[model samples]
Structures are given as structure tokens and as C-alpha cells.
Target chain A: MENKRNSQTIAEYIKNWSRKHSLFIMAYGTGCGAIEIPATLTSRYDAERLGIRGAATPRQADVLLITGYLATKTLKRVIRVYEQMQDPKYVIAFGSCTINGGMYYDSYNTINVLEKYIPVDVYINGCMPRPEAVIAGFQQLQDKIARGEADNGTRYKENLEWYRANQHRVIKNWRMPDYNW
Target chain B: MAREKETTLYIGPQHPGITGNMMVKVKVQGDTITNASVHVGYLHRAFEKLIERRNWLQSFTILCRFCVPEPDPMELTYARAVEEIEGREVPERAKYIRTMVMEMARLQSFMLWYGGQSGSSGLYTLGQWSVGDRNYLLDLFEDLTGGRIYHMYIWPGGVRRDLPKGFKDKALKTMDYIEKRLDEYDKLLFDNVIFQKRAQGVGIIPSDKAIEWGVVGAPLRGCGIKADVRIDEPYEAYDKADFIVPTFEGGDIWARAQVRRIEARQSISIIRQMLDKMPEGEVYNKVPNPMKWKIPAGEAWAKTESVRGEVGFYVVSDGSEYPRRVHVKGAAYTNGVTVTEKILVGQNIADVSFILNSMGVCPPEIER
Candidate 1:
């Protein structure tokens, strides 16, 4: 029913997403790409218009946005934030780090893919995707929300587990594609 | 009884309180932080341990990741360390380019800090302007180093590559634009009344404590300590470039922010000198095959003034193709962990983020 309504009414869909957009986001900046995350959330990009906000506490956040490469050490925090977030939440993996280990593939300590540890609904591609791209990722998350695919439910939980099992397989490290670098 | 009374809060191994990879346990009574134990090694894939396995040249790329925010200093310090060990002199031209790139990174780092520090105070306008202005500089870094943040451009021999044509002119023009925007921020952030009230008397540290605690960069400078690696111990083109190290006597958040603002203006001066007295030569000296270049067995401590504070790399090589160990004796350990916990004790809950930003202690740097 939600999908049908979303497909039928795009304007109403956007309005609904906008109304609840003040998503408390975890700072969660891990790599070189983090420099731009600040750029996107601020006035120039104005992530607030969509209700996207950076949250100091995960319990308050509606979105868990990961910007760029996250080391294994950082991965634990990502999980904690994901756990703290309310059930009806969304996760967007920004830039190369969140999608795939952009440059740190085969790095001694880095986790090549983020999907293993946390449930990510959307992944934006770029070495460090620009602030413009971050906003675009947010809009796509809203659209996904409208479609009801991104709603926090049993489905998102199941997908998070699936990705964790295949985390290494999902990310390719050219240094040691087959393993044992 | 004490443990039960204290509320334990975990900050970064992945928490929003600290940026990057780090987790600290803080026990707070009411909103005041009481006890803090910083737990690094979250991001420590053992960078110091790994450096021993890779050749001298290939190790450069890995070192920059240690301090992701202002990576140029890592590259510069490592290169200088290697140069010191090898007794290789960087060409005059390479020095100019290195100076320019380093200053550019410094300026961008300050701009980014301006946003984070002010935003922590609930001053969003600084966040808006500083981050936007920083992109203009990052664009320059992107053009110069090919990578925006971790420019593996600075290396042991000298630098990885020379400036592309018109880069000098473009960088100078960008500096002018950044200077104009700083004035706008001065009005919005520096001169604003709210920032003053929130940050003025907060996080007071004495000069003796600042030195004892190993506070370098802006925090040390804010406490009226002119402990800048660039001025006290000049490296690269720092000796040639004329600029003043800005300091403040307040020893508070406002003082630290002021030092950064003043330094941003001086970074522009250094960049202009780099361009005006630009040397003409190759960017890098002859570095051996990256996969097999062994550094001679020795220890070299190279420190550079990053936007945050003194960023230094301590490396020891065992006459192998790789380094024996590489340890960082930088600002974050003291500022991010020890001092952050100490000063946050009596402050309000709202000042936590602001205090962290003002100190410019990125958690990953400390944790790594």
C-alpha cells in the first residue's frame, strides 16, 4: 500500500520525507573523504532542508551516514551507532569508503567494505563524493523511503546480515584479490 | 560506589563525540565529565609495525593515512626523516612546491576546524562558510596532488611530481579568494557575540600545564605558548618563507580559535613566498624502486606544524628495504585524550563537542 501510494503520488512522497528529515546523523567521518562531509551538511549544501542533521547520539539519529573509508577500529563505532538508531531509520554509505574500500583496499588494517558490519540502504560512489553527491544520496534515500524499501523492518536487518557474510567477497582488493596479501 | 554513581559514556571506537576511529570511556556525574580513559588501537592496524615491512618509498603512501585530516605533514615529516637519514638534499624547486602544498593543506585544515569548532558551539554559520571556503582550497589540493585528502605527492626524495602548469597562478588566486572570505568569517564567527560567551572562559589550561602536557599547535599557542614547529624548528621552505606564528594568552576556546584565524592569514603569506621565489627543478630526487628501497638503519624525528599542532613522525630503520618502526609523537595523543578528559570535567554537556573541535584532536590520529 505504501509503495502504491508512493508510485502514485511523488509530490506527497517528497512532502512526507521532508517533514521528518531532521535525521540525527553520527559524525562518522573516517577518511580523506570526511573533509567534504562537513561541506555537504552546512549552508552551501543545506542538508537540513531535507531534515538531515548530524546527531551527537545515535539514539536520536534517523540516518547513519558513513563517509569514505572506515578502518576496522572505526567499524565497531559504526555498529554501535547502527544499534543505537531507532528501528525506522535509514543508512547511506557516502563516497568510496562506504561503498567499497575506495583506496585502502588491501590495507593492513582497513575493512574493504562497510556493508559487513552495518545495514546500509544506499551507497554513493566517488573517491570522496562531493557535497553535491551527498545531497543526491540523501534524496535517493528519501525516494527509497517513499518506495518503502528503506523502511526499518525485518528486511533491512536480514540484508545487513547477508552483506556481512559476503563483506570480503563484495569488496575487491586488487593487491590481493584472491587473498593473503 | 563510585563506578555505580558515574555514568559511563563510550566515545568513538565509533561515537559522534570524536571524529575518526577511537573509543574512550568517560564517566560523568550529571553533565560534568568526571573520569576519562582513552582507548586508542582501534585504528591501529599497527602502522608503526607495518612500516617495517615495506620499502622506504612504498611506505610513504601508508604513513599519510596516520593523520588523515592534514596528511601533507605526515608525508613531509617522513620525507624529511628519510632525507636526513640518507643525507640527500632536496632540490630548490622541490622545496618551493613542498612549501606551497604544505601551506595549502594547513590553510584548508584551519578552515575545516573553523566549521567544526564553531558548530560545536551551536554557531552554524561558521560551519556553513568555513566548509564551503575549504572546498575551494581542496580543489587546489586535488589539482596539485591528484588526490584531495591523502596526496601521496610528498616523498623522501623530494615530492612525487612537480606542479602542473599554471598551478602557481591558480594557487595564488585561490589564496586571494580565501583571504577575502576569512574577513566574512571574522564578522560571522570571530567577532560574533555568541561564540565569545560559549568559548571565552571555557577549557582554561595554564602555560606550564600546556608545556607539561605536550600541547603543540593551536592549543599550546592559545595558552600563549608560541610553540610552532614551523617557526622554532623551520623545515622545507619555512626558513625562506617569512611569516609570524600567531599566539593567544587567553588559554581558552576563544583564544585557540583566534590563533587559528591569525595563522590562516600567515599561511597565505608563506604560499605567496613559495610562488614568488619559486625554484626551478625536479620535484623528487632519485628514490629507489619503491618495492625495494631499503632505508639505512637509524632513527630520525621529523616534526612539522600542521593546522592542528606539531605533527611529527618518529621512524627507525634497520638497513632493510623497509623501516623497523614508525611512531607518531603528535598533538592528538595529549590533546585528544589526556587533556580533553581533564578539561571536560566541569564544562556543560553542550561544550563537549565545541571543546573537542577547538583542540582539533581528530580521534583517528590519536587512536592510530
Candidate 2:
């Protein structure tokens, strides 16, 4: 029993270490904050050196970067994408708007608090955070993943009922297939 | 010939090839598209409604969000509309600065468009190179406005600040670098036979319907209209400088690409002229505090020649802190939806993104 427990610990450490090094981001630049993402991913800042690259599909992505405000319409897609990603995924909410709706706070269509419906592992603050700040935020997520402390995906699974209740409350006309994992 | 059954293909809201968060539903018979429809609203944050809730100055922050790649024109148009309604006089220096900023925006936007256009055709090398080369322009914007993507530099009364020291020298140097780089891009993209074959006759925007469908910018210019808001309706210091509205006769993807190619050259020359002939004076005229400021009740319409086309704003003021109604007419509204749908039909599925990029549609502007 003791030998088996030790082997499991070693396996978990290797998994976390591998996960921290390679992050494929599905950057849904849904708002103004998305403008700077290309700047970060492209030659100038080059997030590729840090093992961060863009994934064409949600299933292949490990990190979901929601850049800027999420309208109710986009929120539906965001939830679907977050669910599609594999386990041990991380979410980075870019810009102040994601935290509390920065400029569009008073706007009727925007979703003020993203954390209410989706699990966010890191939040970058700025009206539209610069590439440097975006890189810093990615670094923070990497640190959390390496420490085995980024468990929002696990939390989301344990509280699926509560997350679903919150998600369904705001997203009217929800017609997504049941994602039985 | 046997009758062929049609199948539907949805190409984005998340596809890497499409410009932004918008989908194109195309009905195809084998490789040829029979019917195409645009489904946009993926990126909609309802800017028109949100602008009504905020005061005049507050609206500036959100205005740039309408068109991400070229935001300065939105800021310039909104500011000009408010200024026109109030009948305020802008400083001589501010007009030149506005022109300079607009040209810089045009230059960078073209760089971004180059990345998108070439990348759509599987020329990822040029996309990477141009996008990285574009960092030079962004660095200049950072020096001038203290922000990279959304400058919020061009506002009512005048600019937020004056040109920082040695800005002209840096801008001129960058322009020279870009001028040389354009030749390299020509050899790689324009002069290549593969790109020529892909873009030459694909996505033809018929000249007669071009005006009726409300197509503007390079697409219109590509059809041989030679119409430019900068020349036709001279705003700011555009009249102060001399520049040509380049036109090509084809109206196909190649023609439109040529127009943009020439315009990129024109932007470089215009910036050099503006810098040399720029008058030194106060950069801004003070407006009352945005928190308590109210303008006389009136309505005004203002337009500017953006990289994509004519971007206009119609502001109605009911003598209140918040605008009564702020309606944005982005260049992408017609191009991304109507024009794109029309041109996309009967083309190969492979050319969908290529033709769309040729039109220079910014998706956020369409839904916003």
C-alpha cells in the first residue's frame, strides 16, 4: 500500500510538470482586450518561447484565455469551449472588464463577473492589459500549474451541479448537448 | 451533366483562418460555393447601446473597440463629430497631428492585413515577418500615446498630448525601413505566381454593383472609382498635403490587393509630408470636465478615410452629459456582411478566407 501511494505521487508530479511546460491557448478575443493578443503571440513578445501557442480547436487547448468582456451570446460559446477542454485545464480572464466589467460595467449586454459561470485560475488587471502584463499573467498561471495548486477544473467537476445552475441562470435558450465526462 | 446536390459548410466563429469571431455559412456544390451568408454577432458587445449610457468623453474609451486594427479613425471621427456639433475650433497643430496619427494607423493596419491575407493563402512566413515588422509602428504608438493597441490619442478639441521629443525622426526612420520592406513583400506575395493565380480572378466584386452594395475603400478603389474620403471630402490637414487616390481596374482580389499596396505607399509619403510641413503650436484646446460637461443640443455627422474605407459617426446631442444617440457606421458593416456574401458565392471554398481578407473586413465593427 505504501509503495503504491509513493508511485502515484511520482506520477502526479510528472503530469503537473509536463502540463506547466506546454500550454496551448484558445484565445477567444471576444472584446477590445483581444487586440493585444496578437502582439503577445507574434514576433515582438513571442509567447512561443514560453511554450505558449495558439490551438485551432478547444479540444486541443490546455488554457482558455478569455480576453475582454463576454457578452451573453459569447458566454454560451465560452462555456461550451471550457467544457470541451481536457481535464487539468486553466482559464485566464484578461482585462479588468472580465473581473468586474471594466468600461462596459454598466452596459446591459455584458457579463460583469466571469468567475460566476466559469472557473478562472488567474485575472489580469488593466482596461486593456499590455502584452507585458498578458505575458506576466501567463507566467503566473504557469507557476500555479507547476505547484499543483491550479485545480479550478477539478473544482468545476466536483461542483458541476452548482456551476450548471449558475450557467443556466444567465444563459437563456441553452441548447448544448450534455457533456458527460 | 448530372445535377449535383449541395452541402453546407460553416467556416468560423472559431476557425483560425477567418479574420475574427464571425462565421460564413456557405452552400457548396463540390469545391465551388453556390450560396454564401454571413453570420456575425459573435463579438458583439453592443457598443451603440453602451455608448448611450456613458457621457461624451467616456465614449472615447469604447469607440476604439469598434474596429480593433484601425482604431484612431474611430476616435478621430467621434471627436470631429462632437467638435462640429459644438462649432469648436481645433488648433492648427492638432489637425496635422491627427493626420499623422491616422496615416500611422493606416500603415500598421496594412501590416496586419498583410499578415491575414498571406496567412489565408498558406504564406505563413510573410505573415510572421510583417506582423513582427509591425511592432515598429506599435512601438511608435507607445511612444506617442502610452498605449499599444488602443491609443485613445485622438479626442475632441485636440490630441491627448503633444508629439514626444524625437518622434518625427523615429517615424521617418521607420517609414524608410517599411518602404524597403514593401519591396520584399512584393517579391514574396504580389510577384509570386501562386498568389497571382489564387487571387487574380477570385471573388470578383462587380463594378456596377460596387457602389449600390455600398462597398468602399480598397475594394471600391480596386473597381476603378478612385473615390477616397481624404480627397473627395477633405477633413483635417488632408487638404494641406497632396496625395493621390490610387485605383486599379480589375475589381477582383488582385485589384483590391494592388489598391491596398499602393495606399500603403501613399500613407508613407503622406506621413513624411505631414512631418515636414507640421506647424508647431499648442496640441490641445481645453474641454470642460467630462463628469459635468454638457454640449448644446444638436446633431452632427463626421467621416474619415480609414485603411479599410470611410468610417463615419453620427452623434445626436440633447444637451446632456451622455449623448442622446451615437450611431457608428464602420467600414466593415457593408464589406464584412453584404459585400462579402455577394462576392463569396460561386468561388472555391479554399478562397473564402483569401477573398474575405481582400475585402479587409474587421468583424467587431460589423456586430458592434
**What is the per-residue lDDT of model 2 for residues B1-368, given as tens digits with 9 covering 90 to 100?**
97547898878766777787788999998999999999987777878998998899989888988888888999999999999998878999999999999999999999998889876999988887788889999999999999888899987999989999999999999999999998899889999999999999889988999999999999999999988999999999999988888999889999999999988999999999999999989889989887998999999999999988998999999999999999988898898899999889889999999988999989888888
For model 2, the local distance difference test gives: 0.88
Model 2 clashing residue pairs (backbone): A97-A102
Residue B1 of model 1 has an lDDT of: 40
* Tens digit of per-residue lDDT, candidate 1, span B1-368: 44487788776554555655556577788887777676776565556665666678777767787777787888888888888887887988898888888988889888878777666666677768888778788889888878767788887777778888898788889989999999988898768787788889998877779888778778999999888878788887889988888888988998998888898999998899889998677777877676776667788888887877888778887888777788887778888888877787777666777777888887656755
Q: Model 2 chain B — which ten-residue stretch has the worst lDDT?
A: B12-21
Tell me candidate 1's interface RMSD.
2.9
TM-score of chain A of each: 0.75, 0.91
lDDT of 2 by residue, A1-181 (tens): 3343244477787887788889999856666677777778888789999999999888899998888888888888888888988877899998898998888787777889998889899999986788899999999998787777899789899888988998888788899999785
TM-score of each model, in listed order: 0.85, 0.95
The superposed Cα distance between candidate 1 and the true structure at residue B312, in angstroms, equals 2.1
Write down the DockQ of candidate 2.
0.58
